[model samples]
Target: MTYLEKWFDFNRRQKEIESLLEETIAQQSEQSLTLKEFYLLYYLDLAQEKSLRQIDLPDKLHLSPSAVSRMVARLEAKKLWST
Candidate 1:
C-alpha cells in the first residue's frame, strides 16, 4: 500500500474505535442524565486530580453558586454523589 493509503487506513480504524467507544457510552445507564447532569459530571471528572471542593465546583463551571449547590443537592438525593 502507498503511504497515503496506509495513513487513511490508520485513520479509518481510529475512527471506528472512537465510534464503538461512543456507542458504548451512549448505551450506558448514566446516559439517562440530563445535559446539566452530564456537564456537572464532566466538570467533576476534570477536577478529579485536584482537591475539588463542592463549593468551588460552581465557580469553575461558571455557574451560579446556588445553582451548583442545588445540582449537588439533587445528585446527592439521587445517591449519585456524596456530601
Candidate 2:
C-alpha cells in the first residue's frame, strides 16, 4: 500500500478504537455521564497519582472553576462522586 493509504488505514483504525473504548467506558460506568463528565472522572483518577485539588480541575479540563464545581455537584447528586 502507498504511504497515504497506510496513513488513512491507521486513522480509520484509531477512530474505531476510540469509539469502542468510549462505549466500553459508558458500559462499565453504567452512569449516564456525558463524555466531558467521564473525562473529568478520568482526570480525577489521574490526579490521585499526585495530589488532587479543586483548583486544578479547571486547568486540566480547560474549563472554569465554577464549571468544574457544577459538574462535580451533578456527579455527587447522582451518587457517582462524594465529598
Q: How much is 46 displaced in model 2, in angstroms? A: 1.8
| TM accuracy, model 1 | 0.51
RMSD of 2: 4.1
lDDT of 1 by residue, 16-38 (tens): 97667566656885534545666
lDDT, candidate 1, at 39 = 62
**lDDT agreement of model 2 with the native:** 0.82
| TM-score per candidate | 0.51, 0.61
Error of 1 at 37 (Å): 1.7
- Residues 1-83, model 2: lDDT tens digits: 99999999999999898688778877887677766688788877787564567787898888899999999899999997776
Could you say which candidate leads in TM-score?
Answer: 2
